[model samples]
Target: MRPFLASCLGAACTAALALPPAPAAARPADPSGPVAGPEASRASDLPGGTQSLPLEHLVPAAPGAPAQDMAAPQGGAVHELAPRTVRPFSLVGIVWDDVAVALRGRVQIRTRGRADGRWSGWQDLQNEKSDDAPDPGAAEGLGSAAHGSTAPLWVGASDAVQVRLTLADPHRAALAVPHGLRLELVDPGPDTPAARTAPATTPEATASSAANAPLAPLGATEIPAADQAAAQADVTAAGGAAPAAPVHIGARPRIVTRAGWGADEKLREARFVYTRNVRAVFVHHSATGNNYTCAETPSVIRGLYRYHVKSSHWRDIGYNFLIDKCGSIYEGRAGGVAKPVLGAHTLGFNNDSTGIALLGSFGKTAPPRAALEALGRLTAWKLGLHGADPRGRTAMTSTGGNLYRKGRVVEQHVISGHRDGFKTECPGTLLYADLPSVRQAAARLQGR
Candidate 1:
């Protein structure tokens, strides 16, 4: 058994090590028209989209105040947009032109619900630094089109929005507000055709599904689960060589492929990147708020996909996988689910890890039990594939981040929270605290 585990791990690492990381800056531009796939239909046909509006200096309410209050006693200024009616949107975030610059300020927003027509209180948007980004100097981090962005907040269906940005103390001038600031309103789009009805098959979807071939039928919305023995056989059938001895692997969990979430194949770069091995799993909360239903999960994912690729200018959606509150796991980035697909998530730790994002903000609210269970099941199967122990620790080299310097080899849990890799309140305090139980669940699932 030990020999098989060693062989399995060695094989996985060898396969991925041969493929060097692709430079993000060199990625081909998104195709302007529908791609060649059956799913390569017009972008307009896609349900969700993002609206970006520049924020202007806000006028002071008090008389004789500095125009736009650029130089207040506090030494900082405020930029905002007064409430105005607009198309329906469910999520919002702030983006700046420079990916290298961080937003050193507070972002608050209020929205008028489309159904009730009532204004909600100002909600603070989490300012995520490079915590949710690719490592500096990495191919995924070198993209010229990438933008600095705040964590997106989900506000449900809203027609009117007002945003305010308050820069921090002026004494620290170097940490001033970032340039080219804009407010992004995202409409997850209608849930009907995008989620309920199947669109015409596209070559992209077929290819993506084929990556999980034999485990699930072609064009399958969700990959069906398999027992441990069946899963081991499936891995071998899917091109993974069998080990010398029997490898300890968990049962494969059901996962919704990218096609199941209606990802427009034309929206992302065509090339996929690879990493050596998935040494750890980083958990995160979408921070897009918790106002969605299970049925709306696909639309919400679609909204995030557009925002990540179009608004934030990434190669694709950052997380490797996303889980809904209902415990349904959805494939995020376009790469094959079982492959060591490098994700633009968890800053310095992205190279040898997989990221699983829970679909709603879990800061104040507790995450649903189903979601935690899904997390455990996911980590059990994925980590088991690479011969990682969910309850164990591994040394991971930090490329660069607030918590560690480049080349720092830090010992981390096999299942870790995003905050563990970077300095940010990600996965939220409540969810972060529940990681102990998740590790235990995953370890048990792996028969450890």
Candidate 2:
């Protein structure tokens, strides 16, 4: 019992570390489409109950017109897919081939509501602030990194969709047409009315209750064999057994699995890929807006999963886990929640880390205390499994990016905000500011 107590409790700790930080903002209004036309014919099956239609395959608005480059197409390309009905799909999004090409323009979309049979007003898709690496705009074949996309916008219960791309600022644009454009339709499965009436519990309440359990004071990030040896020595020094070294049990939060959220696992193209040791955890905010209830969170996650895998073309959901404003922890990606599942959340460093995303945009509002505490508890358990101290720093070689060029060796905290690795206000300013406290709380959980 003493040895078990020390191995688990001596394994978690933390410290403070700082690192670097994207810009792009232009709002588009409800730009209506010409008409509700037929759905495009170039549809490809994607892993999760979704389909992708390439812009290149879409015929021009007027017959006989040559295909235009998406960036600066003549008079701004306004192509629409012929309208075709399908099973009630609930989400739509745009996918592009290049991440580096910053278009000085707006991309808008509209969907035919399944219930009304009427097309919704044109809605803009965000082109800036991508969470994945850049895609090469190649002609022959897409490069390994040549897939990027916008955050999927929720369009409730839709059956048809149409899209248009326009260069708002023609002069300063990259002067290149978008090599490829794709639209995706995702079905989040039939609504689970029961989800609305489900009971809510403090996700970390069980862990918090055992907060007073005893633990070895572990200040260092590394919990080597010497610590265990010392614990045994302490027991010997205290008569027969050191009062059973009160075992400090760290409880895991009640995580909602992908199935619990009604995810169509078959839609995923392949099984999850695992990485080696998880050296760090990157915290991020979805930046997808904060207008949602705890009940609507699963729907939001399903949309993001479709956006990431189907539209963005990533291997899986970028984060290993997700947290809602209500402090619920969700097992993100399909891999075993306990494994070192590589995630695509932080660019250039996805292989050695795990990403924990808070489910809403936190740029303006401070993250809920519950959400922050959930993060702390999450890191405590995750990092502890790897014998890492949450308060300490570790080195990782960046594949390269705007902040740290490729092949750069950067030292980051075991628990880091997304900005620490990439140049983005990712976890949000208010949330980034809360990271220090998160590290401290995690350390305390480890008895550091």
Candidate 3:
């Protein structure tokens, strides 16, 4: 059984203990980050038809761990390996960065035992906020720090894993995806079996229910399966691993939203829709404590928009995508989000920004760990397909359109936040602090 984390209010984490705490873990007051903990996000099917690491749903183990040897990475990496029995199993890996002494990121430990080909799933060892993702404390800023992280993962033998990581500096990407840290396979302790492992999954009932409910396709036509290949071709030509850049991506390839003609759904602090052809991503936080499941998000969005558009008199939902406290990504604001038009969310940077509204104001909230990883995976996939450089200073600079900051407006082609081009905390202050990590992650996947 997996562990279900309950203490996480937004992004709070409760780390488990081990013998002689690692040097970094012993460091006091990471006011900006969550300490490491014991967790296993099994990849088997769970309840939501999608998979989220069920925190607190742990299978209790015996005390008294095994003897082990720690293999440290050459650089600022904390690499350690132990047999499932020899060491008290928990998530493990290296700390990437700690800007402002609060904001931190890491190229986490992945794969319980990969080099030796033990059957363990890839485990991201990012010390994430216990609730959603990178739940930055008050000392911690926001953005990726609030929702994303670079912690390593812990897995057993007999699993194959792919490690994905992002760096804190725009200049240097995490070595995890490439070679930030290395893994050494050890014998599974005397107790656990070395069977193969996969990532977690959502419940079928919930997944089916969400699918049956039937929401409208984002404002654009669904990229047909045949065209999916074409879309890939276009992306490859644009400067990805191939040559094309993938400029578009639909949400959760597993679930398909059909196109419909109707009014938008009501959301929790805003009225919104998820349609159109959005081009770039502008990230934000919801700052709420409620945890959300993917199946329950449509109604949440519906109620939110009712407040924002109708109650607040906004044109549409401020964000195009709402990442819930449980790490689910919901659609918002249809017209501009679906299209590449500028938005009201960012100042002087809406023209091409596709605002992804995280379900809480990160300055005060923590998102789910799944949410952060999902964002990383999604962002990487999207940017890779589009050939957009998350950290690249250069842009097409040819978008001749009206952009705006605080609704004042301007024209731009880069993907940025409200603070970058404007003078307001539209995306919140903490989010700006982690943009570098976000962009760096995206840059690595640009045009895949």
- Relative to the true structure, candidate 2 reaches a TM of 0.65
TM-score winner, 2 or 3: 2
Q: Write the per-residue lDDT of candidate 1 for residues 318-414, one digit (tens) a residue.
A: 9999999999999998777887888988988998899999998888899999999999988888887788899999999999898999999999999
* lDDT values, one for every candidate: 0.74, 0.59, 0.34
What does candidate 3's lDDT look like per residue over 246-335, in tens digits?
A: 353322222122111112322111222332233456665543223334544443444343323322234544454566555544445443
What TM-score quantifies how close candidate 1 is to the native fold?
0.83
- Report the CA-based lDDT of candidate 3 relative to the real structure: 0.34
Error of 1 at 438 (Å): 1.2
Off by over 4 Å in 1: 1-46, 61-79, 141-143, 170-175, 194-200, 237-239
Worst 10-residue lDDT window for candidate 1 reads 31-40
Off by over 4 Å in 2: 1-35, 40-48, 51-89, 98-126, 133-146, 158-168, 171-177, 193-250, 269-271
Of 1 and 2, the candidate ranking higher by TM-score? 1
**Which one wins by lDDT: 1 or 2?**
1
Model 3, residue 257: displacement in angstroms? 4.3
For model 2, what is the alpha-carbon lDDT of residue 158? 77
Q: Tens-digit lDDT track for model 2 on 293-411?
A: 78877887877876676566565567888999988888776555556766777876776788999977677799999899888877766665555788889899887666787778989
TM-score of each: 0.83, 0.65, 0.38
